[model samples]
Target: MMVSYVLVMVIIIKGYGKRIGEYIDEECRREIEKKWERWEEKKRREEEEGVREEMELWREESRRRIGEMKERMEEGIRRRIREKIREKKEEIEKIEGRLELEEEEIGEIELEEEGIEEKLRI
Candidate 1:
């Protein structure tokens, strides 16, 4: 009778131990899954930050290029204006003495020179 009782106890212990082991394995799996989720979140945030920084750098470079282009355009305009002024001065000088000019025409030429000088100031 005692041997029978011992055998029943052994069977009960095996059944409950297997259930406990399964419970422990489930908890471990849950913890591992949670950690994986956190790691993925961190990785995603870092990638977004990297992309934002790259865009900022690109914007700065674009602004610099635009500024340089504007400077070049302004310089070209100024150069063209100067060349026109010089050519007009040469033409006026040729007309002043080489022709029989009226006083009014000479005055008009002087006024034209003054206007050209004003444009140069700008």
Candidate 2:
């Protein structure tokens, strides 16, 4: 309201009031245009910053997932190695059991032969 009163006073100054008022109007329009341009530039920069931050977050997430996958793969490999080792151990135990049985049978046959030999001598 104060600005409007001041403009009214300037417009009723003299016969040159119209020209002066037009000049002031032109200056005000230029200032308003400059302000709008600055505001738009600020908004554009903020949007660009937001997009950059989002992209960085996405990249970090991707790296994290990749790390997790790599760890899982390594663990799987280790588990497979352990399983193979267990199978080899079982196979060795079975071979040892068979050998023991064979040795006992051989000893029994030797004792029977000795007894038969003593009976022939008598």
Candidate 3:
């Protein structure tokens, strides 16, 4: 009789232990799934933020390069304009000098013509 009672108790204990083990396994699986979901969500958010930061950095770099290019272009234009102005001034001076020489030649020719006309009249 004692042996029978012990055997029945052992069976009941093993059945209860199996049930508890299954329940614990299910609870642990649910917890792991929840943790995995949270981790995935966190990773996704981090990736999104990292992408945004990269885009912002690219935009900033692009803007900086563009600004530098614009400044360089403006400087080049200014230098070209200055060179043109200098060239124009040099050309005007050359023209003025030629006109002065032409005027002097015309005055000498007029004097020679007047002398020849006076000799003919004599």
Q: State each model's C-alpha RMSD to the native.
A: 14.3, 7.0, 2.9
Identify the runs in model 2 with alpha carbons over 4 angstroms from their true place.
1-23, 103-122
2 or 3, which is superior by TM-score?
A: 3
Ranking by TM-score: 3, 1, 2
lDDT of 2 by residue, 72-112 (tens): 99999999999999999999999999988988888888888
Best by TM-score: 3
Stretches of candidate 1 above 4 Å error?
1-13, 100-122
Q: How many clashing pairs in candidate 1?
A: 0
Indicate whether candidate 1 or candidate 2 has the larger TM-score.
Answer: 1
lDDT of 3 at 25: 100
Clash totals for all candidate models? 0, 0, 0
Tens digits of lDDT, candidate 1, 1-122: 99999999999879897998899999999999999999999999999999999999999999999999999999999999999999999998988856656677778898999999999998
Best by lDDT: 3
